[model samples]
Target: MTKKDHEESGLSKSVWSDADLEEMGWHDATVHALFLQPGEMASRLLLDLDYPVRWVPPVRRRDPFTFWVAPATLVFEEVWDLEGSLDFKGLAPELELDGIHRLAPPDGRAEYPLWHLEGHAFELKFRASGFRQYFRQAPRHVAGPMLEYADRGGCAFTEVGFD
Candidate 1:
């Protein structure tokens, strides 16, 4: 679905907008994995927040603000082009995201937007027709190690006796 459609549907409501991301602070967020699909159909970038944010219920406000780390997956659909320099080898190799930016479509690509994902040691540039962010699971009070544990059918916290 388009960004507007996702917004109106409520089911896939965005957890954070550009301004919200900036305000909440996504700098230094850990990127555990980057998945590129065949045929450039889509790409998924998994991230673990460096600084957990306070959780605010949608229906009501609560006292004693609860902080949580919600791992997120950014899906870029209809990827037209993707270029990156990254290595996923070594012990729990991960990238520290400097920032993620949504830029206007490049020339001759009016229908797609360019996404720039910058990290401490790598950079990814892509053009996709659609994009969405999905939280992997319920928020946890503590941020686990920077790794794609959920995708591998494991819970980082559980392994560390934090669950």
Candidate 2:
């Protein structure tokens, strides 16, 4: 991928460029191949905090990784939307280094006072700047103040889209 073609991978064009990312010899497909489930890839990053990944499975395929060793990246137009500049940028990395998992299935729910995390199957969403944990799936019981803070900060969580 080239900086001029940043749109091809649906990465944060503002934060990453094709040319810069190419220096690392990695593509969305390359990371996707490393993980099987949808949140699996992002969870690795969130857990390790070594990279920022946005994995979107192709529209035709319901599964993010069709094979155990699928190395090809899927092409799609949708992307995750994140807003506002980060204040505590170190939060993500710190959390990951502490051995924390920030993804949850719909059957499970976790909360951290002001924030919550929830996911369904392959889908996941986190709504906090630097949470010690993940989001809770309980939609109705979410913290109103935390959500309001997220809203004021241009949506605290990154909105992911699948093709």
Candidate 2 C-alpha lDDT tens digits along 36-70 = 22342232212201222333344566644221111
Best prediction by TM-score: 1
Error of 2 at 38 (Å): 37
Model 1 error, position 6 (Å): 19
Whole-structure CA lDDT of model 1 = 0.52
Compared with the true structure, all predictions reach lDDT values of: 0.52, 0.23
Q: After superposition, how far is residue 81 of candidate 1 from its true place, in Å?
A: 1.9
- Model 2's alpha-carbon lDDT is 0.23
RMSD of each: 9.2, 19.6
Candidate 1, 124: how far from true, in Å? Answer: 0.1
